[model samples]
Target: MTAPAELDAAGITDPALRAAYTTCRELNARHGRTYFLATRLLPRERRPAVHALYGFARYADEIVDDLGDGRPVVEKAARLDALALELDRALDGALDRAVPGGAMGHPVLAALADTARRYDIDTRYFRDFLVSMRMDTTVTDYATFEDLAVYVHGSAAVIGLQMLPVLGTTVPRADAEPAAAALGEAFQITNFLRDVGEDLDRGRVYLPAAELAAFGVDRQLLTWCRRTRRPDPRVRRALAHLVAHTRAIYRRAAPGVGMLEPASRACVSCAFALYRGILDEIEAADHHVLHRRVTVPARRRAAVALPCLARAIVARTRG
Candidate 1:
């Protein structure tokens, strides 16, 4: 729980606003472990904005996905709707001339509004993201890759788009958008491949249903795999196919690392390597994602991060 140095660097000096940014930073560190690690590699000045984005997303996700017993789906949907409206108000409040940053009552949204204003990020991305969060309430599985792409675009791709400003791309946004989108999709698809069991427990399956059927997998088979903790060859095959597909997306996203501002490059490269590493770990385990979560070992993360650490230091020193 170190104080967020980035908040000060970003000119967020008001005591209440700084506290709001701190709350967002805590959310990122607590729930977004991998994402938090990535933020650590960024220029300290830029980290608060990334934390704000992650916090906003995590808050909405919890509302939709972490409801306890006796909470009906309708209630969760209504809560999600409330959140979307709150976000709308928060964004509008940012434009107010009288209030400083027009921060809303919700600390996370207040921090998010400040970041959005600072970066001149489009509000449409937030609206699209809320749409996907709302989708999680009812959409359990996708019928095709095309259908799934639409949801993932809102859920994950816009996140990368939202981050482009904070990351400080060297190229025009138009040139960089495709790569950012591919990277986002790659990360989410990797999560889907690794979290198949946990997602099933939540009564959701992110894998395209058609892809599953192509490998003779269905909901029941996935449940059996989860219960048995034994690898089914067909399941393994399907997972492998997805792993390869995700790798292709990673490849598509790789060049964007070089396209980021030099000060930001090391951080994003670190993240790209680390997330892509999850795909490798999944393969090494022979695609046995149904039984347990696959993760890059801490030692391995340290190894991958070492060079980026040096690059980040150089970038900071140059500044």
Candidate 2:
């Protein structure tokens, strides 16, 4: 991945968003090697915006995951809160998203701000995204599936909603926004499941606490299972069930992709393909995320393109 750049603006301190998106061709690598071809194929105008979202998300995620600051949690939390407010200001039109088209600082958010302004995506979603990031400070367990979904709505769903207006181009709020949200939800859940061990190590648990209790899985068991060299039976079962749930989400979710204007399919296709790979990788790992995180290889990623490509081609031919 390219380095995160500093935004010329007062708020967008991360620039990786701009560097990775200088070419949509690079996004496939940012998400995974399997997604490049499809990204190259996105709706021309919207691909850059999708790249902007990816970069934005990467920047926000790094705030929690970087682990380099070596500061007290209190300090980190406060910093994140301030960053969140800045991001909100950028969204509310109070500040620019970047240095400016011609300005200095961070090229990414600047480019992104331009992208957001050109489209009609709201500022609220960006604010919600910060809230989701702040959750990393202490939110380890979820009380229920609904609770998890609600959190996912803010963290991931908002990212999708932010991109809808960009994809619509002409109509702006076109038919795909809901589908985009579904896509975001599907991706985030799959990510949580796939990164069980990694999240656990961070002293964060993303699995539903209530569900884990019902499953007879406790925190100690979760810790041991995740820290081990191989996944235990309980972890395997829980992960498999989660993958199955993800499949269901995808089923409900895929329809939203089909609802988009044909031009927008590539954006959905690339993002969908990456998460689909995660689901597939989870299955291949025997749902053993407690043992290790699984990733799709390039060859398989290449295969992912065929189905989507053929579908896109057929859609265009028919159109």
Badly placed stretches (over 4 Å) of model 2 are: 1-37, 67-70, 88-105, 169-175, 306-319
What residue runs in model 1 are displaced by over 4 Å at the alpha carbon? 68-70
The digit string of per-residue lDDT tens for model 1 on 66-97 reads: 65324788888898889888988888898554
Q: Write down the lDDT that model 1 would get.
A: 0.87
Question: How well does candidate 2 score on lDDT at residue 278?
Answer: 83
lDDT of each: 0.87, 0.66
At residue 27, give the lDDT of candidate 2.
39
lDDT of residue 187 for candidate 1? 90
Each model's total of backbone clashes: 0, 10
Q: Tell how far residue 160 is off in model 1, in angstroms.
A: 0.3
Per-model TM values vs. the true structure: 0.97, 0.81
Total colliding residue pairs, candidate 2: 10
Model 2, 1-319: lDDT tens digits are 2223212221333344345346333433465444345554553444566566666666666667775245667876887877665554555442354333432224445455656665756867877887887787667778888888767988988877886775553343646677678877888888888788887777777888777766577778988876667566776776677788788888877877666667667556766877788888788777766767788786777676777767666655765
Q: What is the lDDT of candidate 2?
A: 0.66
